[model samples]
Target: MAQTSSHVDSEDTVEYWLFPNISEDGDQLQELEAFRTRCFTFIQDQSQNYIWHEDSINLKVVTKRTAGDNPPHLYGKTRYGCNVEDEWFIVHLFRSFSVTENDVVIRIVDSDGDFLLVEAADILPRWANPESCINRVFIHVGQVHMISIADRPSSITPLPSGQPSLMDAVHIVRSMPHLTIAPSPIQEPIRQRIEKCVSQIDSSLHRCNVFVPASVAALLQSYPTLVAPAVHAFCQRDASQLQVIRAMRFFPPETRVWTSVTFTKCLYAMLVHRNYQPDHRTGWTLPPNGDPKRTGSELGMKLAVGFELLANEESLHQQGGDYSLEMDSRWNRFLNTLKEKGFFQDFLESSQPYNELLEKAREFYMNSVGVEGPAKKPVILRLMQSVFADIEKFKKEEAHLPADDDDSWLSVDPATLDQILGDKFGLLGVDDDEAKAEILPKLETFLHRKSDYEGLTPSSGRKKSRKLSHLAPPSASRKTSTLSNTSDVSQLSNHIGFDPDSFASAMQGILDFALPEDNWDLESNSSCLSSYSEEEEGGELVDKEMNNYMQTMDQELLSTDVLRTSVDNPTRKESVMSEGCESFSDVENFQPVKIDSAALESLLASYTMQRGGPGPASILLNQLNLPRSQISASKKQTD
Candidate 1:
């Protein structure tokens, strides 16, 4: 038989030896014994391939702690100086393979006299060949002794190197369970039910005063949505029941008790839910700022409506019948009276009278037209005169009228007066053709100045131009001229071609003559035409005839004055000659001065008595004092 190595050895070698003579009392000897015992126990428990030799007595010990065992005791001395017997275990078969400084071998003998041989390779497992037995043992034993034998590697293999692919990571991720994200689901049917109820409530609220069941449902649904179910659940009641309870809170105690109804509570709850804050307590004070009495807009609108009614003649007539026009006329006059008396505090205060007058004006409407006609013109005029007379009497008594204060709401506007007059009377003043011709021009001029006295211009591009042509001829041209200027004596004299005193006297006489006589009659009856005369039927007949002649003469004079004094007065035709004066053919020696002087003196004397003047002498003296050149100067100045 060929002799072969009893223990197989290779270039990768492992050694097995025993550490036998450990001193128990030595610092390191105890550690050695523990380590040796642990290794022996591990090797014995391992598979039979790593079994300890049972017959070994002298064991080969190899260690780097010392070159060989020291003191040569049978075993190492104990740390406490106790003697310990050393037992030797021999190697049954020994073989030495290549060894390196990094390789370690551990050998142990237990109390049973069994040998434990452990060979560990020092090379890293990452660099070891899996097929080599030494590397296989090394990989199993591990550089870290704490590693469990169960986890030890049977073999080691080198990892091939290159750029790592991401596919492995992607596959790993894909294999994981998916995590989904989605929006929370809505209870759409519940929302629809709430919306439908709300819509019904809104519709019912617009038409009916009472809240219906649908409204209650809507309110209940909204409450659930707004307040969490956890909070609402505290009541532990159904929505309908809760709504009924809420309605009770809103209803007044009295209403609920008296009417046996709870609608008020429902209304209150709805208002509360909608965030409406109403005065809930009995007798709660209203907001001071919201007081209707203090609101100017409300007062203004009321006054505007009142005036509009007052100004509408047709409306007035409809309301007041045949008397409506006259009633409206009276209403306007009343407003004017109030305005004149300073009852109005400002232009705005005019509305007070306007509002008050509306009640009186209603008689003018068609609804009232069946009523008796108002006493016509003359009666109306007389009534106005009486009213004014009373006012004058009050003034004479020196009684204090109510004065305007800041809070007083009396006011008047010229425009308002114009509207009132235009609506009712068609216009103010006389309607006769000649009287109108005389008054219209003066009135137009007066109105124009009144309308634009402040002279504010329109800011817009389309500005209106003043139409001054309506002014009287003299006023339209005179320097510093006005209607007041028409009263200047010298100017009148120059314009009329008479002495200033004479012209003034003539004007006074004309005005006095124009007044209607108290006793004059519109009827042809002689008794009606004149007061009873004592001369007729004795003194009565003659006196009556004389009175009638005087009355007739007065009427003729008044009619002439009315024609002559007017601006539209027709010119009288002049005779070619007069009984006392020369014909036009004898114009050169006419001697007009003496005649004119005599005529002027007579006229002045008569006018002085009629007009309550100082005397005829005073009139003459005033005329004489006027400078001859002063008249010409005044004319030039006026021009």
Candidate 2:
């Protein structure tokens, strides 16, 4: 017997050799069972009793199973089982190990004729008894081992310990109330493009580049919702950002119109937060009707119109209120000081014209005081009185001069007169007719003769005396002389005890003195006589006459209360000038000579001499000594 080849790819081959007793002699089955029991018992006892035997015996059983059927079975039957049972077992085992449909298990062959049972009883039920029926299949002879058993995974590879599984993560996101489903990862490139655009816009806005428009527009094209907030942020950082948005808006959808209002509001907010107070000086001045731009388009002119309305309302309120006069006065004073410091020119350029503001001020005053009669009277009176007092004080101080008897005269130099006239009255250069007509008479009056005798020159010889006679001109001489005598008497009365007899005697002596002779040829000359006479007699007489006249004028001027009243009320000067013709004696007395030939010549001579030359004075003096006819002819020729 070629030892039945046990390594066959069939379960029948191995099963038939292992247990033959089941089908053999019935009585002998007990002994066979006992032998099998003893074999198992021996292996169990050896495992319990000897540590080394445990491992060796385990190997023994495996060795026995691997060895072909002959030795193992022969030894078991002869030593432990009956002969009859052995023979019968072989045949019956072969029959009992027959392959059946239900028991069809896959068989795998080994090189050593050993087999591994891979059946329903040896593995988990899920694998052995799969819901789907499986037919056993055989594998050909080779060393074989089980690879993967078909089994149900414990909970589908239980979720990771701490982190959410893929499904869990998805489910959690789905369940969230606020979470929005993000665009798919497939759209990542698009999102990246949008992000890049936004970044560019942000960078451009920071750098204050105009490229912000293109960048912002591209971003909004992809993500429209981003427009408003982006604009807001941009504007918050830079007030001028709105300009970019406005430009972009011009492209499409008319975003500019919407942004215009928002931009204006934004500007207003920024200004208000900064406590921006516009200078009233810079307030827009409307043309008489309205600004052309404002008149054309309501929308275009909204800001201008609104500002105007606001300004008007404010003006009305201020006018209607009881404003602080003191505060206004202080502000005016401050403005004046600023003007004095040269800031007024800048202010005028930068601010409103002063005249407009002044008109506004007057309007405000009137409104505050009410429209009723006499409501503004007191303020006007006070203002006028203050001005009058200032004028009077200035006139008194400015008119003050050396007493008439003083040797030095306040004669104005011709150059100084020329400069003053040129600057004040816009005269330039000289015109002979104008000089003689407009200037000479004024000069003569202002120079008023130093002494009466000084007028008696040989050249002016009898003509001057004739003019003196005309002083109390022929028509008025009698009345003038009587008035003059009375005036002298009155003046004498004020200074000395009134003894009519002595006063008469003094007048007689004055009358008796011979008129001084015109002696231009004398050694001292007429000029010398004039000088001495003026010093002794003319000065004393002029001083006395002036004092007396001033006193009498004061008495008469005060008697009517005209001077006091006029001094108290300055508007009277214009009224009196218009209606009454009071001689301007005060003005005439204050007026200085239009030209002082001597003084001018002296100045020019000094200037010339200092520059190493003879002066204009010497030249003029020489010219002056020439005959009057020659002088007149020369003047006519020049003219």
lDDT of each: 0.26, 0.28
TM-scores for all candidates: the values are 0.11, 0.15
After TM-score superposition, what is the CA distance of residue 91 in candidate 2 from its true location, in Å? 99
Candidate 1 achieves a global lDDT of: 0.26
Residue 630, model 2: Cα distance from true site in angstroms: 19
Off by over 4 Å in 2: 1-465, 468-638
Give lDDT: candidate 2, residue 331.
38
Please list the residue runs of candidate 1 whose C-alpha ends up more than 4 Å from where it truly belongs after superposition: 1-412, 428-639
* Residue 121, candidate 2: alpha-carbon lDDT: 17
Model 1 TM-score? 0.11
Which has the greatest lDDT? 2
Decoy 2 TM-score against native: 0.15
For residues 73-104, could you state the per-residue lDDT of candidate 2 as single tens digits?
A: 21211110111122222222222222221111
Worst 10 residues of 1 by lDDT: 77-86
